[model samples]
Target: MKRLAVSLTLFLVLSLGVGLLVSGSEVLDWGIAGGLFAIAVLGECFRFWIRRTRSKKRDSSSV
Candidate 1:
């Protein structure tokens, strides 16, 4: 499941990269915006993950 999530993330990033390369005339501009949004979402996900991991660790240590 973790591997699938990682792979899908990579796939989306690569697809956006290819889209930037293959399109012409304002094609890349939109892709850039999309890329930024993707990055922001990923950042939030990572923050949540870190918080969850830390809480889990603390819970286990306290027991």
Candidate 2:
């Protein structure tokens, strides 16, 4: 989880930096940044859901 968060953050920063350098447009940069942010949030939500389901399975099996 920690690693995932770190990697996602790094990717966002790197992407934004590259986008800014290539486009030099704040409006486009914000658009790209918003898309990336949405993707990151979705990824985290998916990860959390997977972990929750796995833990529930483990708990049921143990009982």
Candidate 3:
């Protein structure tokens, strides 16, 4: 969880920095930053879920 939080924070900061550097419009910058943040969060969640499910399958098969 701590690692996830750190990764998410890093993603947000990088996205915001990139957005600001790439776009002149305030709204577009924020939109780009928000979109990237959402993608990072969803990707992390999906990876966690996949790992959890795989572990569960392995544990059950070993029983």
Each prediction's Cα lDDT score?
0.69, 0.76, 0.89
> Model 2, 1-63: lDDT tens per residue?
788779788878866875676566453566776677678778778988999999999889853
Ranking by lDDT: 3, 2, 1
* Number of the candidate with higher lDDT, 1 or 2: 2
Q: Which run of 10 residues does model 2 get worst, by summed lDDT?
A: 19-28
The per-residue C-alpha lDDT of model 1 at residue 5 equals 70
Task: For candidate 3, write residues 5-63 as lDDT tens digits.
Answer: 99999998999887888787564577878899999999999999999999999889853
User: Model 2, residue 21: what's the lDDT?
Assistant: 69
Question: RMSD of model 3, in Å?
Answer: 1.9
**Model 2: residues with Cα > 4 Å off, grouped in runs:** 21-28
Which tens-of-lDDT digit does each residue in 34-55 have in candidate 1?
Answer: 7655775677678779989999
Task: List residue ranges in candidate 3 displaced over 4 A.
Answer: 25-28
- lDDT assessment of candidate 2: 0.76
Q: What is the lDDT of candidate 3?
A: 0.89
By TM-score rank, best first, the candidates go 3, 2, 1
lDDT of 1 at 53: 100
For model 3 the local lDDT of residue 17 reads 89
Positional deviation of 61 in candidate 1, in angstroms? 0.9
